[model samples]
Target: MLNTQHYPQMISPSLMGEWIVIASEQEFVQRQQIKTCLDGQTLTLHRDTINGVHVYQVNFESLDMKELNLSVQAAYGFVWLCIGSEKKPLFQLQEYDVEGARRVPCGAYGVRTSPLRGIENFLDMAHFPYVHTGILGAEPETTVKPYKVEWREDVDEIWATECFFTQPLAAPSSPQPQETEYVYRVASPLNAILYKVNTAAEGIIPADVVCLFIQPLSETHIRAHLLMILDDQTSSMTDMVLFQQKIFTQDKPILENHVPLKLPLEKLEIPTKADALATAYRKWLITKNWCYGVHKNTQEEQVV
Candidate 1:
């Protein structure tokens, strides 16, 4: 066997069963480091200075890479599938063929076909601008404002139109159900966002972030898990459920039609203004050395 000892990294397969290695290191015994590639672009990761010690951080807004998390990967895949036009048959664990292929246990959301290929990067974000256009994309300005948000090395500035307005824009409804409801949106192992959407475009603010998890299912599939802490008790089950369904349902049909094809991400044409986020996203993906879309620029790894 080739001496794998020198390369101590996490290994897994993509949904298509392609082998992958997350080459990374740890600063201290307790601190761990992981890497990921997006759209076939490798990212140069570095330590972020928090209070004092080093911590993992990435600015998706700026295309910076730091650490790897499975939960975030799943979130990316989930949204990617919901928006892309390529078609592929994906099944949940409950609906898989046991004899045809071995079932691999995945993360909280579980695994499905990889949705990274054949996707138009900005179109998905643009969908949010026009489709869910009610609350978030209320205006053309909001769609582009967040792009101008500044960033710091330690704190990644996120200007989510979803969380932009804190106070409710609508009046509260009648008494809600008994159970407390919450929605969690996480992007990495350390960061998370939580809240509920009730009334027209009104609800409580996302107060506390809980945890983030990312895991791989197969050669092309990955899972991203997120946890959130509720700030207060409430009776908003109906409102929250409706919100989740509305958002997810709108995305489901769009995602299910994605074509099953992988691009030589490294061979893509030069990016343009619309691809600002994708440009950054590609850089981050390169660090992992595996991504879905075509890329014109490829960094030559120096083998000295």
Candidate 2:
């Protein structure tokens, strides 16, 4: 049986419940069988597309098999599977005002790192110039300007705005270097969305949305699922996927090698002005009492 006390922050009750990305819509359609190991249990998810309707069945090793009547819907080109109470509200992608926004399915990457590490990396803008190099950021323009972080009590979400960065290739459809404006939202502990200026597209829309949802298989194992809703009219889906993949490929090694796999809620090794958002994120996790992937300090009181 799964222990709720030891469950990762990604599956904490304060954030609702566990929602995992089993496969992408294309992968489900092509393979028909999706296999995942959750909490040391292997789950075989089978799909049957009949009359254009997708049906799913899950089989657990040495356990009762069941067919799920839930309809499979593609949200921004990815298929998500939730394993929790039916009463919990599901995570929804933010609606953009841009018409004809193209959805791209960036591939899922398996990483040997904590889910929190994946998100912490995404939230950090200071490392872009060093980690992503000229693609996402360049040298001599490494200043991370002050940004505002607010906790929306009404929605119980964290929002960060007024972020700006210079990028050589901000978008796959654009070749010119430009200053990219960014806004980030932490919808849940394991889910985050970034909105950035789409310089390559012609539209009244203010920005495009890129979402990263982390699935925590264990304290040190995770799969990063990426999706983008962009206003770009020039780039093919394949090109867009490759571009995002390249950026993530550059980050994978750094994330995997990060010491202290679990996140530290206090006493950070390095501190900077850009870490305001990350600081707020750690406090939010503490408030929720979610500590499965957090480093424990023997001197501090146990979080239960």
Candidate 3:
């Protein structure tokens, strides 16, 4: 179990069933002991291999030096830590189980922004043309088409589909520009998955998945853990990782500077049809009664 007193906003029951990224497998292997501060408390993570299976042991300072018997492991080169009970189902979906998809691990990048803000920015496609420029989007193709957004009753997840965008370099192996179709899923408040059409090759691939898992250290700090499950038969893993890093590098400044750090659940001043997914996400957070990382103008309206 996680120390909820140290991470009340992140350890809420609403997010108990979700998995959080603590460190990369490489980071743990290289450092041996990884130290992180969460909610003003220090957590030291140590790596161990049991019967040739990699695992991690975590020690919390606030818990009176008690060692958590958690066995952290790497899935697709990411070090994952769970906060919930063993009986609860994980937030993973079948889409993430791509057999031949190359895993490109984008190391945990720190940002002085709310975790919700990082996710909301990832869900925003309109910024590609301006922020990502020629890589993801470009000028004259800036219009965002209307997409469908709804809560899936069967899975209890929010989805947005029918999203199409023209991109110059949608993937590292692409030779020319293509029209990319996308489907976005908010698996949880701190997790999001994107399924995109890979059209750079003959017989375009139906879907290439990218998962974003965010760790909220505080109300105003977060670390983005990105994993890309791609279908590219070309391009080396190093090339793919560099390409993805450049895109996020461009997004970092914009994300870090977002006003009012915490997300606002109220109506926006200039809400557009393109913001449908973000709107739905905000509604979902409100429904879950998750307000620790949210902001309200009046003290009486705050949830903390």
Candidate 4:
């Protein structure tokens, strides 16, 4: 077993039946067994040549492993596990099938914070000039212009479009600074992706898709699995990986320092225009009655 028994705040019922990223597909392919926890119970993922992948949860009574009935799935180079009787289909990523695009599954990066907070941090554009300075954004152009935020009924996704920001280095292959357009999509409370299209002088290009599939170890612990499908052919694989690692490492400390730890469902802090997407994200959670990893200001939490 990779970890021991979990005794965290119980994951809410509303968050069930949803697909959660468990581990990188390659990780399991390399190491057959990956043991972890979910919903306050310990889980072991075993991949075999004959039986395929089997998930076993710790039997509380006997402290023995009992195989779960549900099956594990592989999508976009990552393994996923669903926790309830009813499982929703994983979100679609058309960018993954695009020809000539580079697929980079950078593996899991741990963060000691709420999964909601992790996703919210990825959706914010205002922090770029400060948090990821000189690479994602720069000074004097930090204004987050008015963007369109909508809840697509058909897809059940929160979409934020018409978002633009000036970046000193938008991608590993970028030669100069440019104005970048972004379309941020929140597939679920813990899963989000942003399509980045940098301004070009000659031809139109497909946006590079960057996805954050969060694995909630508990209410406060998370494994941020970053997957990217890019149109760049010039940059080396090492450069692309380093660029992403650099960006996320910069945001790690800030995410961990959040006072509440879990996202507050109430109006605890005042948000400005730049937080339009984040504001809409919270409202969407309220509509679904999602209670996982969320707290209210009236109810205080003990900070450890």
Pick the TM-score winner. 4
Instruction: List candidate 1 segments past 4 Å from native.
Output: 1-10, 13-124, 131-143, 146-214, 222-235, 260-264, 267-275, 288-304
Residue lDDT tens for model 2, 99-157: 68787768789888877888988899999899988888999989898999999877677
Evaluate all candidate structures by whole-model CA lDDT and list the values in order: 0.31, 0.74, 0.76, 0.79
Instruction: Record all residue pairs in model 3 with backbone atoms less than 3 Å apart, i.e. clashing.
Output: none
**Residue 211's lDDT in candidate 2:** 87
- Candidate 3 local lDDT, residue 160: 98
State the weakest 10-residue window (summed lDDT) of model 4. Answer: 1-10
Show where candidate 3 strays beyond 4 Å: 1-17, 64-74, 84-88, 93-99, 201-205, 299-304
**Best-to-worst ranking by TM-score:** 4, 3, 2, 1
Could you give the candidate ranking by lDDT, starting with the highest? 4, 3, 2, 1
Please provide TM-scores, in order, for all candidate models, with all chains considered together.
Answer: 0.39, 0.85, 0.86, 0.88
Cα lDDT tens digits, model 3, 1-304, are: 5555664433444444456667778686567788885544468888887898887877766655332234355665666665445323346655445566666777778888878999999999999999999988999999999999999867678999999999998988878998899999987778799998887533333577788888777767888888887888788889988988898889899987777777888764357888989989999888878765676767533211
Clash count, one per candidate: 45, 0, 0, 0
Tens-digit lDDT track for model 4 on 1-304?
Answer: 1111251333346556688877776776567777765645566676656465444322222233333234467778877766445445889998787667789887788898888899999999999989988998888888888999999978889999999888999988888998898999999878999999844312223688899999887778888999888887777898888889999999999999998898987888789999999999999999988877786676776432
Q: Write the per-residue lDDT of candidate 1 for residues 1-304, one digit (tens) a residue.
A: 2232342343211222221212222222353433344323333334445687444432232332223222211121121111111112221212122222111121133223233421232123445545455533444433332232112224332212232222211112323321122232322211233334433222233232222233333323433332222222342545533443454445544443433322334534566554444454444345445443222245432111
